[model samples]
Target chain A: MAHSGINLIFEGQNLPRLLGGLWITIRVALIAIIAGGVLGIFLGVLRTFKNRFLRFILRLYLEFFRIVPTVVLLFLFYYILPKSMNLNLPAAEVATLVFTLWMAAEASDIVRGALISVPQHQVDSGLAIGLNRSQLYYYVLIPQSLKLMLPAMMNLISRIIKTTSLLLLISVLDVINVGQQIIEANQKQYPQGAFWVYGVIFVLYFLICYPFSLLAKKLQKD
Target chain B: MSWQIIQQSLPMFQKGFILTLQMSALGILGAIILGLMCSLCQYFKIPVLKQIVGAYIELSRNTPLLIQLFFIYYGLPGIGLKLSAYTCGIIGLIFLGGSYMAEGFSGGFDGIPNSQIESGKAIGLSQGQLTRYVVFPQGFALSIPALAANIIFLIKETSIFTVIAIPELTNTALDLIGLYYHTNEYLLVLVVGYAIILIPLSIILTWLERRIRYGTFGD
Candidate 1:
């Protein structure tokens, strides 16, 4: 062993660096969720439009995002898109873009399902009154849909957090990437250093995702 | 632009494609077995085994597959349990996929009315016999759609193997791009490669779902 034992990876300097990387991971996830949620709502509504052409386009968009793996999307945005378009975007920005695209597609489907799941009688009763299209959606549909959509949306948010780890492939210094770097740098000292490094990353993700999953379950139960 | 380059690279991609398919097949098989066993144990309310399986499901499902792959690939070796990258990838996939599949299967089991089971019991069938004759068939039938969706999900999830240097389709693309940094066609290749596999797989799953729903065994 060239360096100190496995304890060194967690000692004075490395601990704070790991924490800093985790903070970045959390920041990326939070920002992506907020942005993706807003976009998802818009796309979801677009998907449910009465116009066949609009629905077709939205379906195409959703399928495109859903079928392709996020890693491939990240690679495209991070490496190829910038070079082709002559725009030098940061890795975090690219990550946000790819994640938002993914979330929008997934969330749109959830929203559409939630909206359609609202009973037809509710819509008819709203129409039986003098409520206009905007009023009907705003007053009756959206409120009810929100109750159904919220739990699924929470699951999507946690998924976004976990998926942020893929940004490591694009050279982003998220927690996992940072852990990998530390392990590689100290590998000569601690031959099996990855155990602690990646173990810590696993715990960090579990901490973030588990609570949200519980909340989703509770909401679904209610 | 060069057929020569593509021709030379064809074998590498082919090898990768075959490995990807094999890993997926083995992973899917392992997942079905693990998932079925877990579901059965939970369904029967086995004493301590149920709790153990439940914990496994929760721990696996909540974490990302990438970290699990790293843990299995790197962590196992630290404990004197050595596994090749391919074996590690398959094991990781099996654990991850089994957790998800067990949930689906359990959901299917729950969907079966309790009356069905009670009716079986009234006929003087043993618990094992009830599960085999009455519960399992209906549960499997009802779960076809979920199982199909899970299969598609598993296929997409297999792409994570690239990170562990498993030489899957994605890894092949990464290697090609790394080798020929000048060619900006890597993304296009990846898109085409994945689309070729996934589009047909999705279609087949849809068709299977429809067939199962219609209760028409193939003619």
Candidate 2:
């Protein structure tokens, strides 16, 4: 009754464990995306502000995140931050924090691009119509920018989801971690478990992300 | 931040940096070649191969490199393909980067005007000649920015090669930290190491992109 070969992936609740791990990945990504999206929009708006000092600081912030690899950031947060700050945080929390920051940086860039892409004449007309700055942005700019930003945002969302796989390196028990555990456990019974297990995880990620990518393409076309 | 730890680990970090550079160079070169082939296949609409390339691009792009590395490093051995970690790292990078590069290249291909191709054909150029003369140069120029972005991306992705135990920058930092626990210093070293590599690489690429956009390369 021993499950052999690929069957080892399903044997004794392995599949569910992998699903649970994937759930963690999705949950972290969702939380990061939602929180990061809001922060990103605010930063994006700020990024377009005319103040040179603020823009300079924001540019530094963006470039810092862009230049530093996420894994290094993960270590900085998961290991160094706790010791330095004397705060104990879970690996998942650290993962989420780093991801949220990264997402915000990228999303802000997209938002900034989208906002700037609105025709200058549109802004001028809004201003000439006696719209206040906030009113003009709310009524004239935000709506138009949303369309331009949507496809890119969707693409970013998929990218963030794919990136959550890195959380496993920090020991967050993500889908990859779960797959590894399953493989190690079944190494004797199914020497090929890594192939099937990782293949399945790959498929799971593809199933989740491919739709978003396709949707992004469609949205761009529209 | 203890300066001594950084001083002590300077050699380790340097070795890792060089290794990272070598790996990235090989991976980027391989990816460019693979990407060109794939884009050309798509551009020509080769029968069966086009669909296969399409599927490959999606599969490669959709999955994380970490899992791909895992599959390559741990899984392939099951089928008797056993490869060294360094080989696995390069292969993994090429696999992941190839898709992105293909997209970048195909975008370039798409930018080539229909008239350009038609003109080339009217000029008595054969199919090979048309591809060589008309499409490739213009397409490559158009794709330079995207391809540069992909190059930087692939380089950043080399950070993940640590998972497969390649002695890249991140892995070296992690290893030294594990041994010494001078977390802050090593982390600083890691960031500085990446900064040294990535910042210059990006700056150079941006320069190259600008040159291609406006310099003699464009004309």
Candidate 3:
């Protein structure tokens, strides 16, 4: 073998580059999750609105995100938007935006389910106590919804992080991309370079996601 | 966008579209079978196999599908286990989708009351008969919604194989885009191609889910 275990990875600048890429991956996932969570919470509340047009429009947005694959959205947003509308955003920013769209749509559904699952009596009792709209939500509705949403939201966040791997397709230089970069840089030197490269990538992703999912499950049973 | 180019490219799209369907169909079938095995192992608490199967599902679930694909496609070749891109793509899907379907199946399998199995034993049924008759039918019935959801998820995920240059619909569209530079036209074609498969699949799965819920489980 031209190369052996961890040698390609820890070589000068290779490890740092991959680590930098991992940081970016986590950063993007974080930004998307936070921004998506806020917007999703708002849109999810809108979904429960009594107004026909509001509900219809929100439903359309949700369905559109649901139906379209993130890879398609990535290509469309990364390429088409910049070309046609001249948005002039970097590829990473565009990728983040598309990811946010997916995360928000999914979070909207989760929030909707969690919010709706709160018993009618809780809301009625809150209203019976003359709590105004904001007060009722803050005091009664939001607390229960948070509890119900916690596990699913945890799972959702982990999922969003995992989905960020699609960034490789967009040339986002995520860890997966970094691994590919390592493989390419050493492909001639190390024929079996992909094994070590992807093995490390898998470990990095699993470390990031497994704990979150486990936490979600733990919280769920509690 | 070049509408004329799209019109001419319909045949290419059709060829790629059919492959996507085949991959998804085969992938989903493979996943369901593997998932059922995993679920059965967990349900029976089979000796070392249960923990191994559980870990396999968890690991598959936790990691990104892209790495899994690469691990199978590029990494496996290191061990002289080379497979074609199409085969690798489907294998990746089967395992990834299997993890999901296993989770779905386990949800239903775990929910099957112990009494049902005990009743099966009392009736002089073997473990196989108990699983086939007492467990699988009810578990599958209970799992329809989740399994249907998994199917939809699996279908959408078939697009990921484009990374491996699988000549699936997305890959074909990418190639067309490179050729035509009519970005909108090819992208639209890609979206419509996926919609044609997924929209109908989703609708059918939903209908099946509802039918099972009412027809088997009852109101």
Q: What is the interface RMSD of each candidate, in Å?
A: 1.5, 0.7, 0.9
A96-140 in candidate 3: lDDT tens per residue? 898888888999988888889999999999999899988887788
Query: What residue runs in model 2 are displaced by over 4 Å at the alpha carbon?
Result: A1-4, B118-126, B214-219
Interface Cα RMSD for candidate 1?
A: 1.5
- Relative to the true structure, candidate 1 has a C-alpha RMSD (angstroms) of 3.0
Give the TM-scores of the predictions, in the order they appear.
Answer: 0.94, 0.96, 0.95
Model 1 lDDT tens row, A1-222: 445346856666787898888888788888878888889888887777799999998899899887888888888788776777888888988888888788888999999999999999999999999899888888998889999998999888887888887878888888887888788888777777887788877888888899998898899889
Fnat, one value per model: 0.55, 0.78, 0.77
**Native-to-model Cα distance after best TM-score fit, residue A83 in candidate 3, in Å:** 2.3
List of chain A TM-scores, every candidate: 0.93, 0.96, 0.95
- Model 2 C-alpha lDDT per residue in residues A1-222, reported as the tens digit of each score: 254477887688998999999999999999999999999999999999999999999889999999988888898899866797987999999899999999999989999999999999999999999999999989999999999999989989999999999998899988899898898887887888888898899899999999999999899889
Q: Of the pair 1 and 3, which is ahead by lDDT?
A: 3
TM-score per model for chain B alone? 0.89, 0.93, 0.90
Best by TM-score: 2
The whole-model lDDT of each prediction reads 0.83, 0.91, 0.88
Give the higher-DockQ candidate: 1 or 2.
Answer: 2
Clashing pairs in 3: none
TM of chain B vs. native, candidate 1: 0.89
Index of the highest-lDDT prediction: 2
